[model samples]
Target: MAIPKVFITRRLPEKCIKPLQQVAEVKMWSEEYKPVPREVLLQEVQTSHGLLTMLSDRVDETLLAQAPQLKCVANLAVGYDNIDLEACRLHHVIPCNTPDVLTETTADLVFALLMASGRRLIEANDYLKQGKWQEWGPFLMAGADIHHKTIGIVGMGRIGTAVARRAQGFAMNVIYHNRRRNVEAESELGARFCGFESLLETADFVVNLIPYTETTKGLFNQNAFTKMKKTALFINAGRGATVDEDALYQALLEGEIAGAGLDVFSQEPIPKEHPLLTLEQVVALPHIGSASVETRKQMISLCCKNLMRTLAGEKPITPIETSR
Candidate 1:
C-alpha cells in the first residue's frame, strides 16, 4: 500500500513526529512556535491526506476546497473554533481535537491567573523592580482575599469541575452557572447551580471556562461587568471572544470590577498599545493555558494518534460531534 501523506502545520516534539513519520510520509512546516501562512497551508493541503493543525490556523471552506483528498484534521488544542466544522462536513472530512488530556493543566493556569490578579502579584513585582517599594506599609500592595470567598464559575465543564476541586482546599464556596445544570457536579464538587445573573452578582472571583459557541460569544459584556461587585476579580482561561474587550477596558477604567486575569484575549499577541495592556489592574498572558511541557507533549501525541487512527481505517480516539 502507498504511504499516506501527512502535513504538520508546526514542528512538534521529536517523540510525536517520530511515530507519525514511521507510518506516513510526514512533511513539517519547520517553525515550531509560529503559525504557518494561509497560502502555504492551502498549497500543502492540496497533496496531503491528513493535517495536524494548531488552534491558530483558520481551517475554513476555502481551505477545505483546496484539499479534496484531505481525510482528517486533528487539532493540537481542545478548542476547534478555528476550524469550520460545517465546511469539513461538506468536504466529507473528519475533525478531531485533543480534549481531556489538557483539562487539568488548563485549570491550573486558571487558578494561577486568578491568584495573580486577586493578590496583585504582577503589580507588586513591578513595584519592587522599579524601586517603588521603600518599606512595607500596613496598606501596601493590599488586594482582594481569595480564601474562603465565593467563586462563581461560568461553564461548568470538566475544567470547571477541576477548578472547583482545587478551590475546596481554600474552603471557598463554589457556585457555577452552566447552560444546563449538572446534577453530578453538584453532588461531587459541592457546587451549587445558579442563574447567570446570580453568579455575576454574588461571586468574589468570577472564572470563565466556557467554550466559544454561537450562544457564548461576547457573553461577558458591559452589563455583566456592571452586575459584579466593585471588589470582584474576573478571570478567564476560556476562549477570548467570550468577553468584549472594549467593554472589559471600560469596566476596569471605571472601577466596575476590581481586577482581571486574562490568559486568552480577542486577539493573540495583543498590540503593545492596546488599552487593556495599559491597565495595572488587568493581568494578561500570551494564551498559555495548556502550555506545560508534559501536557503539550501529551496533546501532540493525542493529535497524532487521532490522525493515525483515522488514516488506518480505525475510529478516531476523540471525534467531535458535527451536529453540535
Candidate 2:
C-alpha cells in the first residue's frame, strides 16, 4: 500500500513536523512568510491524504473538490472560521482546530493590548523616539487608568474567561455578554452577565473577544461605538470582521470612543494606506495574539497530532462541529 501523504501549507519548525513525518509522507511550502499560492495548494491537495492549513489558506468547496483523498484538515489556529466546515462535512473530511492550548497565551495578549491602549504606551514610545520630549509635564502623555475599572468582555469562551481571570489580578470588575450566560465565570470570577448594549454603555474598557460568524460580522458598528463611554478604550483581539472598520475609524475620529488597540483587521496584511493606521490613537498589531514562542509550538504540535491521528483512522483531538 502507498504511504499516506500530508501537505502542510506553510513551512513550520522541523521539530513540530518530525512526528507527522514518521507517520506519513510530509510535504511543506518552503516559504515561512508567504502563503502557498492557491494554484499550488489545489494541485498538491489532489495527491494529499491530509492537510495542515493556516488561517490564510482558504479550504472551501473549491479546494475540497480537488482534494479527493483528503481525510482531514488540521487548522493551525484556534478559530476555524477560515475553513468551510460545512464543505468539509459534506466531503466527509474531519476539521480540527488548535484550541485550549493557546487560550491563555491569547488571553495574555488581550490584556496587554488593553493596557497598551489604556496607557497610550505605543504613542508614548513614538513620542520619545521622535525626540518630542522636551520637558516633563504632569499631563504629558496622560492616558486612561485600568485599575479598579469595569472591563466588559464580549464572548465568554475559553480566551474570554482566561481574560476575566487576569482582570481579577488588577482588581478590575468583569462583566460579560455571551450568546448564553457562562455561570462559572459569574460565580468564580465575579463576572456579571449583562445585555450587550448595557455592557457597551458601562464598561470603561470594552474588550471584544467575539469570533466571526454571520451573526457576529459587523456586530460592533457606529451605534455600538456611540453607546460606549466617551472615555472608553476599545480593544479588539477577536476576529477583525466583527467590527465595521469604517465605523470604528469614524468613532475614533469623532471622539465617540477614546482609542483602540487592534491585533486583527477585517483584511489580513491590512494595507499601509488603510485609514485606521493613520490614527495616532490606534495601536495596531499584526494578528500576533498567540505569537508567544511556547504557545505557538504547542499549537503546531496539536495540529500535527490531529492530522496524524485522523490519517491513521483515529478520531481527531479537537474536531469542529460543522452543523453549528
Candidate 3:
C-alpha cells in the first residue's frame, strides 16, 4: 500500500513537521512568506490524504472536488474563514482549526493595539524621531486615557472574553454585544451585555473582535461609525472585511471617531498608499494578533497533529463542528 501523503501549504518549523513526517510523506511549499500558487496546490492535492493550510489558501468546492484522497484540512490559524466549511462538509473532509491555543496571545495583541492608538505611542515615537520634540507641552501628543474608561467589545468569544479580563486589570468598565449573551463573561468578568447600537454609542474604546461571515461582512459601515462617540478610539483585531475600509477612512477623516488600531485589513499586506495608512491617527499592523513566537509554534504543532491524527484514522484534535 502507498504511504498516505500530506501537503503543507507553507514551510513550517522542522520540529513540528517531524511527527507528521513519521506518519505520512510530507511535502511543503519551500517559502514561508509566499503562499503556494493556486495551480501548484491544486496539483499537489490530487493524491494527498491530508492538508495543512494557511489562511491564504482557498479550500473551496473546486479544490475539494479535485482532491479525491483528501481526508482532513488543518488550518494554521484559529479563523478558518479562508476554508469553506460547507464545501469541506460536502466533500466529507474533517476541518480543524488551532483554537484556544492562541486566544490569550491574540487578546494581548488586541489590548496592545488599543493602548498604542489610545495613547498615540507610535505618533509619539515618530514625533521624537522627526526632531519635533523641541519643547514639552501639556497637550503635546496628548492622547486618550484607558483607565476607568468604557471598553465595548463586539463578539464575546474566547478572544473577546480574554480581552475583557485584560480590561478588568486596567480598571476599565467592560460592555459587550454578541449574537447571544455570554452569561459567564457577564458574571465572571463583570461585563454588561448591551445592544449593538447602544454599545457603539457607549464605549470610549470600541474594540471589534467579531469573526467574518456573510452576516458580519461590512458590519462596520458609515452608519455604524456615525453612531460612535467622536471621542471613541476604534480598535479592530478581528477579520478585516468586517469593516468597510472606505467608511472607516471617512469616519476618521471627519472625526466621527478619534483614531483606529487595525491588526487585520480588507487586504493583507495592505497597499502602501492605502488611505488608512495616510492617517497619522491610524496604527496598522500586519495581522499579527497571534504572531508571538510561542503561540505560533503551538498553532503549527496543533495543525501538524490534527493532520497526522486524521491521516492515521483517528479523530482530529480540534475538529470544527458542522451543523450541515
Candidate 4:
C-alpha cells in the first residue's frame, strides 16, 4: 500500500514541520519567498492526502477536482479567501486555518503603522538621513496626534477588536461598523456601534479591518473618501481588495484625507512605481501584518496540527465550515 502524502506550499521551519512528517510523507516546495507554481501545486496534490497552503495559493474548483485523494487543506493564515470554501465542502475536503494566534501581533503592527504614518516617522527619518536637518525648528516634520481621537474600525472581528483594545491604552475613542453589532466590543472595549458613513465622517483615524468579499471589494471608493474628514488618517491592515487604490491615491494627492498607512496592497510585491509609493504621506510595508517570528511558527504549528488531525480521523483545531 502506498503511504499517504502531504504537500506543503512553502518551506517551513523544521521544528514546526517535524510533527507532520511523523504522520505522512511530506513534500515541501523549497523556496522561502516564492510560491509554488500552479502546475506544480496541482501535480503534487494529485497524490496528496493532506495539503498545507499559503494565502498566495489558490485552491479553487480546478485544483480540488484534480486532488482526488486530498482529504484536508490547512491554510497558514487567518483568512482563507484564496481557497474556495464552497468547493472544498463540495469535494468533502475539510478546510482549516490558523486564527486567533496572530491576532495580537497583527494588531500591534497596525497600530505601529498608524503611529508611524501619523507622526511622519519614516519620512522624517529619511529626511534626517539625507542631511536635510540643517537647524532645529519648531513643528518640524509635524503630524497628527492620536490621543483622545476617534478611531473608526471598519470591521469588529477578532483582530479589529484586538486593535480597539490597544486603542484604549492610547486613550482613543473607538467606534466601529460591522455587519452585526458586537456587544462585547461596545461594553467591554468602550466601542460604539455606528454606520459606515457615520464612522468615516467622525473618525480621526479610519481603519479598514474588514475581510474581502463581494460586498467589501472596492468598498473605499472616491465617494467614501470624500465622506471622511479632511484631517482623518486612513489605515488598512485588512485584505487589499477592500480599498480602491486609485481613489486612495487621489484622496492623498488632493488632500481629501490626511494620510495613509498600508500593509497589504492590491498586488502582492506591489510594484515600486505604484502611485501610492510616490506619496510622502503614505507609509507602506510589504504585507508584514503577521510577520513576527514567534507568531509565524505558532501559525505553522497550527496548520501542521490541523493537517495531522484530519489524517488521524480527528476534528481540526480551527476548522472552516462551508455548505455550498
lDDT at 120 for candidate 1?
98
Off by over 4 Å in 4: none
Residue-wise C-alpha lDDT for candidate 4, range 54-162, written one tens digit per residue = 9999999999999999999999898888999999989999999999999999999999998998899999999999999999888999998898889999999999999
Checking candidate 1 for backbone clashes, the offending pairs are none
Candidate 1, 1-324: lDDT as tens digits: 889999999987777678888998999998977889889999999999999998899999999999988999999888999999989988989999998999999989989899999999999999999999888899899998889999999989889999999999898999999988878889987999999999999999999999998899999999999999999999999899999989999999999999999999888877889999999999999999999999998998998899899999999999887774
lDDT of 3 at 47: 92
Q: Write candidate 3's Cα lDDT for 1-324 as tens digits.
A: 789999999988889788889889999999999999999999999999999999999999989999999999999988889988888888899999999999999999999999999999999999999999999899999999999999999999999999999999989999999999999999999999999999999999999999999999999999999999999999999899999999999999999999999999988879999999999999999999999999999999899889888877889899998666
Worst 10 residues of 1 by lDDT: 11-20
TM-score of each: 0.98, 0.99, 0.99, 0.99
Worst lDDT run of 10 residues, candidate 3, spans 315-324
Which prediction has more favorable lDDT, 1 or 4? 4
Every candidate's lDDT: 0.92, 0.95, 0.94, 0.94
Cα RMSD for predicted model 1: 0.9
Error of 3 at 165 (Å): 0.3
Q: For residues 21-109, write the lDDT of model 2, one tens digit per residue.
A: 99899999999999999999999999999999999999999999999999999999988788998899899999999999999999999
